[model samples]
Structures are given as C-alpha cells and as structure tokens.
Target: MKRIAVLGSGTAGLHLSYALVNSGAFQVTVYTDRTPEEVKRGRVSSTQVHFGPARAREAAYGMPLWEAGPELESIHVTVGGQKLFTGGLVHPAKSVDQRAYFFRCMKDLEAKGVSFVYGRVDEERLQELARAYDLIVDCSGKRGPIAPFPQIGELSPVTTPQRKCSAGYFHGVVPLEPAGVSITILPGAGELFEIPALTALGPVTILFIESVPGGPLDVFGGIKDPESFRDRMRAVVDRHFPAVAARVDGEHFGLCDERGFVQIAVQPAVHRPYCTVGGTLVLGCGDSVVLNDPITGQGCNTASYCAEQLVRTLTEEPVGPWDERTGEAYWKRIRDYVTEVTQWSNAMMGPLPDHAVGRLMAAAADPAAADRIAGWFADPATAYEDLFRSAAGTKEQAERQGGL
Candidate 1:
C-alpha cells in the first residue's frame, strides 16, 4: 500500500482521510496539532451547513453521522428589516458544531485504522514528513498550507478582508418556521445569518455577523469575554435585525458555552493547490487552497467537495509516484468548481449587483424562482450563473442594441 500523509484535521483532511482509508488502497496517517479532547473543548472555530451534496459525500465515505440537529428545509431572506420569501431546499442541510463534529470524526477514523500523530507539524518536521511519506496532502485550513503553494492572482482579487466575522452558538433564539437558515442583509453594513445547529449541549442557534469593517454591525472588537460578546450580539440584533430580535428570548439568550464564539476576518484568496517540497509532491485542499469569505457559508461544503475529488483522482490514476501530474489531474477536475464557488463567494461580500438584486426581488413574487435561489447555496454553480452569467448576457445584449 502507498504511504500517504494528511496534514490537519478539518473537514478537508478528515473527509479525505476517511475516503482514502475506506478504499483500502493506501495507509493514511493524519497529522494534527490537537487531540480529540482538545478539539471538543476548544473554542468554536467556524459555522457550517453541510448541504445535500456534502452530506452525500460524507455518507459515501462512511464518516460519522449525527442523529441530532435540525434538518434545514428552507432559506429565509430579509433585507433591511423587510421579510422577503422563504425558499425551500430540494435536499435538506444540517449544521453540527465543528468542535463536536471534528472531535467525533477523529476518534472514529482512528478506530477504523487510520493513524493519528498529534502535536504541531513545523517546517522542519514537515520536511521530515515529506521525505517519509509518498505524498503529502495539506488540509491545514485558514491557518496554512505550510507548503509554498503560490497564490493564484486572478482568483485572489481582494487584498484585505471584506467582513469582520463574529459568530456565536447560542441557546435562546427561536427557530424560524420550516426550520431553516435565516439571512438578513443590512445593505452597506453587513449581514446576519441565523443557523440552527446541534452541539454537545443539544440544539443551539448560531448567529453569525459578517460585519463590513467599521460598520454598525462591527461591534465585537476587543470583546474578549463571552458575556460581553453575548451582550453586544444581543444589542446588535435588537438594533439592526429586529426580525431576529423578536425571536430572541431575553431571559435565556446567551452563548451556549463560554468558548462557543469566534471573532475573525478572512482575506479571501485561492492558491495553485499544489507544490513540490523537498522533491515530494504536496497538494492543498479545502481552505488551504480555496480560501474565501464565509458570507456564503461554503467553506465546509467546498472542503467536502474537494476531498471527494481528491479521492477520485487518486483512485483513477495509476499506482506509482504521485507527482505534479497527479496534482494537475486533481486540479483539472476541481478547477471550474473552485472558480465558480470562489467568484460567487467574493461577489457576495460586496453590494449585490442590480441584476442579482432584481432576481431576489423577483423570487419574492415567484415560488419557482425562489426555490432555484435556495438551491444556489446547495449547488453554487447555479449561483454563479444567476449572478455572473446573466449579467454578462445582459451586457452583450446592451452592446448589440447600441451598435444597431
């Protein structure tokens, strides 16, 4: 069996590991900085909704499943306090706290015969690993690829972060009717995303604030303690998002745990996903390669998608030295997908284009359009078409009319 070393244990690393081991074709060893206990106890890192496709991939890989959490059926949209329409998803999505999800998966994968090596893998240690393993797959998430994978300039247009993201898993927010994710866009200010999720403590609501820097919703700066974060979030909701505020139960409204909140900003970028380190081929997956703003909630879903593609690439290719050719094949299969997702995600961070806004307004009047809008989150390629391709078509039509 070929020896493969997978780094980091986020959705990408874990999912890839599970798929690889299930094939019984290679010996997979996961190198992560934290143990399962540490992961379970650590502060919440992200908010996610595993859409239909991502969930299907998980099942195919035989990854651990969660019996709890609400099955998200629709997407609720509100803009500037005005309620639009709720679009139903064809296949339901689910959000499980990554702290719990990652912890459980790591433990389960180990039991299934995947090796786990704990502690940080620094540059020296990484070089050692490159020499030791036949191939190295980096799934280090936002913190790294560790390997020098050159950034793709065309894909990475933004140099600074578009949103200051503050998210907390809370206990007192009531679920919307039909049990789905709620998105409130505050125009130039930012957005509020209310997600129903499952954690170790049972069902909790995640309120994620994507604040345009220095905007009204960017109020969590310098707030270290949970009480302060909760108070600020409550105030923000009450002031800016009254629809959600109306659902908040004041007496019990607070973070589910002290560590359930995270405050960070992401400078969206995409990399070439492959590099050579000490003559060994290194491949990047998930956030390490296709980092984008979380406004669209595609991080975990994209990671899951890439993981499965990596597995397919490896399985289809001949059993030999996994080099740049292998990397190119994997990239070829996923490039268009990664591009569509990244572009759509980046587009969402700015003001919604007039055409895109027109579509949303039209969706409010048409259920079929609304349902298609809902499906965009589940399958982002449709979103790219709606937001970009449609606009391009309109521009071409305008040019032709002018020429005539």
Candidate 2:
C-alpha cells in the first residue's frame, strides 16, 4: 500500500485523510496530540460560518450538510452604527459545531478504512513515521511542534500583539435578520459577530468580540477560570455593547475553551521544505502552513481549500524531487487568496478604511454597493475586488502606515 502519514488530526488533516481514503489508492494514517474523545471535546472559538463556496467544499468532502445541522441564511454588516450595504455575504452561508463536525469527519474516515495515530510527534517519532510513509503531511495547527513555523519572510499584518478576543455560544437569542450572521464593527475599538448555529446538542448562538490590545479587558488577562471569563465578557458587553448586554448569560456555557486574546498575523512560505528524510520530503498543510487570523472567520474555509489542494496534489503525482514543486504550488495557489483575506482581516482590527467606510455608507445608501461588498465575502473574485486590496486607497495600507 502507498502509505501517507498526516500529523495533527484537525480539520485539514482529517479532511485530507478522508479524501485519500475515499480514493482507495493510499493508506492514510493521522497522528494527533489528543485522544479521539479529547479531540472531539476540545474547545475552539465559535469560529466558522462558511460562505456558499466553503459549504460546497464541505459537501464535496462528504460531510453531511443536512445532518451537520447547518444554519444557512445571510450576513448582516455594520460599521460604527452605519449600516454598510449587505448582499449574499455568503449565499446561504452555513454554520456547524466546530467540535461535532470535526469528529464526524473522523468517524466517517475511520469507517472507510483510514487509520488514526493519536499523540504528539517528537522529532524521533516523526523520523520513524518518515521511514515508513511515502509522504507526511503536517496539519499540526498553530501550536504545531514538528514545524518551526513562526511568522517570517514578509512583514505580517500584525507586528505587535493586536487584539484580545472573547467568545461563547448561547442557547437563545432571536437573530435580527433572517437566518444570517451579524457583524458590528466599532472603529479602532472592537468587532462583534453573532451567528446562530445548529449544534448536535441543539441550536446555539455564538457571540464573539475582539478589542484593541490592552484596551480594557483586564479580567481576560492570563486567566483560565470559566467564572472569571464569563464575568469579564458580561462586563464588556454591558459597558460597550449594551443593546445585547442582558442577553449575556453564563448558564448556557459551562466551559469556554476557545476564549483567548492573541495577536493575529498571516504568513506562509511559498518554497519551504516541509521536512526532509534522506532527501525525502514531508509537507505542512492547513493552519500549520497558513493560519489566517480568525478575525474574518476564514480559518475553516481556508483549511478546507488547502485540504482540497493537498489531496489533489498528493494523489495525482508521485512524491520525489517534485515534492518541492508541489509545496511551492501549494503555497502559490493559496498565497494570493490568503493575502486578500488577511488584508481584509487586518482592516477589521483598526478603524475601517475611510474608503471602505465610504463604500459602506454608499452601500447602505446605494443598494448596489451593499450587495457588492457582501458578495465579496462569499466569492471575492466575483465581486471584481481583491479581499486583500489594502484599505489605503491607491497606497498599500501596510506601506501607508509603515506599520506592517
């Protein structure tokens, strides 16, 4: 059997494993840092609400959209209380429980005959794996140990620690619009996202906020207790976003694992040797290679996109000298798209670009502009706009601010 080892059984690792097993040409084994149950129970931020294209990818991956309990509706957008134009931000944008959906992928892949190797991968363990498999894929995510992938090469969108994010999923909160997501951007202050989700446990609401670093959330500072976290969150909502303040309750959240405030940046080298063994190469995929700041909720979508490309490349060709080429191609295909998404994400961290603000004002005032920007989220290319087009008109924002 042609053997491939994938480190990190997260979304990218699991999805690629599923694709390869379904092909029946490769024997795929996934190595993860936690048990299947632990992996299943792991806490992740209320992070993903897919655009139509992303949902399509999920369906293609054989993740049951119906059983996954997706909430497909629309997205509502506003900046500084000025309603920007909204369109099909995600034409039928859909969401699912990150934890549940992840496990479901694992279960289906196992049923189809893929193997799971659970535990952390030290260098020696990886070497043993390298000796056995024809190829190795690192999907170890942000905290990956196998790859020393700290942000390097290009200047990242966030140089210093950027924002602190707090989030939780609630059981009830009547949405403001018809089955869509909501975004409220307070210039240079914070960003809020509310999405209705269909969890296996039941329907839940995900309310998340990102604030300017060191702004005022002292309670979230190096804290791990649930009581403290929820209290801090409630205080924040009450102080800044009082409209939905009272609805903030800890009753629904027994524990929140995805709550953390970390700096955000974008980086992926186009031609790095993922790993080498006697001239053989193992590559990094998913967030290990490219982690878009979750600022705009593109992490899952990007993971899916990379997983698809990696699957196609691994199955279609032989892994030898061309492995480097494959890695470059992997980086090439995602670089532009990620750049667009990252730029857009970085923009959310600060004051909305005046032009973007103007565009929003124009969109709210002009229906056409509203639809155009909203469409950009689902299919950026279709909008004839680059999601990463710098917020600085003409001048790249990175250069204009000389900040990045």
Candidate 3:
C-alpha cells in the first residue's frame, strides 16, 4: 500500500483522510494542529454551509450522523435594503458549526484507525514528511500551500481584500420569513448572510457580515469581547437591515456560545497546487491551492468537491507513477472547476453587472427566474455559464431549463 501524509484536518484534509482510510489502498496519516477535544473547545473558525454536493460527499463517506439543522430550502436576496427575490432550491443545503463538525470528524477518523499526528508542520517537518511518504497532500487551508507552489497569477486576480468578514452563530434572531438563506447585498457596503444552521448547541442562526474595508459595513474589525461583538452586530442590523433587526430580540441577542463567533479579513488568492519538495512531488488540495473569497459561499463545497476529485484521480489508476507527472495530472483534473468557481466568486464581490441586477429584479417578479438563481448555489457548475454571463431573456431560459 502507498503511504500518504495528509496535513491539516480541515474540511479538505478530513474528507480526504476518511476516503483514503476506507479505501485500504494506502496507509494514510493525518497531521493536524489540534485534536478533537481541542477543536471542540476552540474559537469558531468559519461559517461552513455545505451545499448539496458537500453533504452528499459526507453521507457517502459515512459521516452524516449530525444533529438535524435547518433545512435550507431557498435563497432570499436583497440589494441595497430592497428585496430582490426569494427563490427555492431543488436540493437543500445545510450548515454545521465548524467547531462541532471538525471535532466530530477527527474522532470519527480516529475510530476508523487512521493515524493522526497532532502539531503544526512547518517547512522543515514538511520536507521530512515529503521524503518519508509516497504522497504528501496539503489541506492546510488558508494557512498554506506548504510546498512553495507559486501563485497562479491569472487565477488569483485580487491584491486587496474586498471584505473584512465578521460572522457569529446567535440565538434570539427570528427565523427568516422564507426559512432559507437571507443574503443582503448593500452594494458599496458589504453583504450580510443570515443562515439557519446546526451547531453543537442545536439549531441556531449564523449572521455573517462581509464588510467592505473602509466602507459603511466595516464595523466589527476591532471586536474582541463576545458581548461587545453581539451588541455591535445588533446595532449594524438595526441601522442597515430593519426587517432583520425586527426579528432579533434585542434582550436575548448574543452568540450561541462563547466560542461561536469569529471575525477575519480574507483576501482571495489562488496558487499552483503542486510542487517538488526534496525530490518528491507533493500535491495541494482545497484551500491550500485555490482560496477564493467566500462571498458566494463556495469555499467548503469547492474544497469537498476538489478532495473527492483528487481521491478519484489518485485511486482510479492504481499502477500509475506518483511523481511530478501524477501531481500535474491531479491538478489538471480540478483546475477548470476551481478556476470557474473562483472567477464567479470574485465577480460577485464587486458591483453586479447591469444585466445581473436586471435579472435580480426579474427574479423578484418571476418565481421561475428566482428558482433558477437559487439553483446556482445548489449545483454551481451547471449554472455558471448562464448565471454569470448574461441575464438577457433569463425568464424564458429558466422556464426551458426547468429552474435549477
């Protein structure tokens, strides 16, 4: 059996480790920064809402035994505080608190007898691991492309951060009128996403604010205390989103737990996902290679999808060389998909094109158009061309395409 070293235990690493562990085709060892217990007690990392494909991958891997969270049936979009549209999805999406999800995933992997090393793997350790293992897969997330793979300039089209993100899991907010994802775009300001999610504490709401730096939405950058964060979030809602504010019970509005809130500034980037270390080729999977802005909620789903693709590529050809050529082939398999998602996500961070705005208006008036737009989140690959290109005649096209 080939020896594989998977670094980091985020969505990509855990999924890849689980798949390989069950395959019995390789001896997989996962090195992570923390153990399951540690992850459970740590602060929130991200607001990971896994769409249809991500959830399917988890179910396929036998890790879907999560406490039920809110069923995301549709997407409600508002621009500049005006209602754009509310559209239903063909397949539902779900969000689990990362602290709970990551912790449980580690324990699951451990129960399956997968080897896990706990600690950070710096350059020296990574070089040593590369020499020892037949394959070294980096799933270190936003912290790296550990093998020094050069950034893919064309693919990484952003230099400055478009949003300073503040996200928290809270109770006391009234459920959405539509009972789905409530995404409000403030145009020159940032965007706010109110989602119903399953966390360790059961069903809670996640309010993710993407503040455009130096813009009106940039308020939570200095928050450190939990109470201060919640109060400030409430104030932002009251000022910008009166409808959502009306739903928030001011007396009870706060984080779901002490560690259930996170604030970060994310600058989107992409990199060449493969590189040579100590004469052995190491491959990058997920965010280690293609980290896009989360404006469109593609981060976790894309990572899960890419990991599964890598698993298929690596295992399907058992007798192949695990060298630079193999690494390059693995990159090729996921390149287009990653690039498409990145471009589409980046496009969403800026001003929506006139045509796109018109489509939003049309969606507000037409249910078929609204459903088509909502389907973009469920299976992005299928809707990429139509969703991003032109909004011309979308109502007719949506009717013909059967509303994604």
Cα RMSD (Å) per model? 0.9, 4.9, 4.2
Pairs that collide in candidate 2 are 85-370, 340-388
Instruction: Give Cα-based local distance difference scores for all models.
Output: 0.92, 0.64, 0.84
Residue pairs with colliding backbones in model 3 are none
- What is candidate 3's lDDT per residue for 331-402, written digit by digit as tens? 888887887788778878888877777778998889999998898887776466665544446656978899
Model 2 lDDT tens row, 101-186: 77777777777777886667987787788778777887877565375434544535455546666666655355555667778777
Model 1 CA RMSD to the hidden true structure, in angstroms: 0.9
Q: State in Å the error of residue 129, model 1.
A: 0.6
Clashes of each: 0, 2, 0
**Model 1: per-residue lDDT, tens digit, 114-190?**
99999988788889998899899999999886889999999999999999999999999998999999999999999
User: Could you arrange the candidates by lDDT from highest to lowest?
Assistant: 1, 3, 2
Residue 175 displacement in candidate 2 (angstroms)? 1.9
Listed in order, each prediction's TM-score against the native is 0.98, 0.84, 0.94
For residue 140, what is the lDDT in candidate 3? Answer: 93
- Model number with the top lDDT: 1
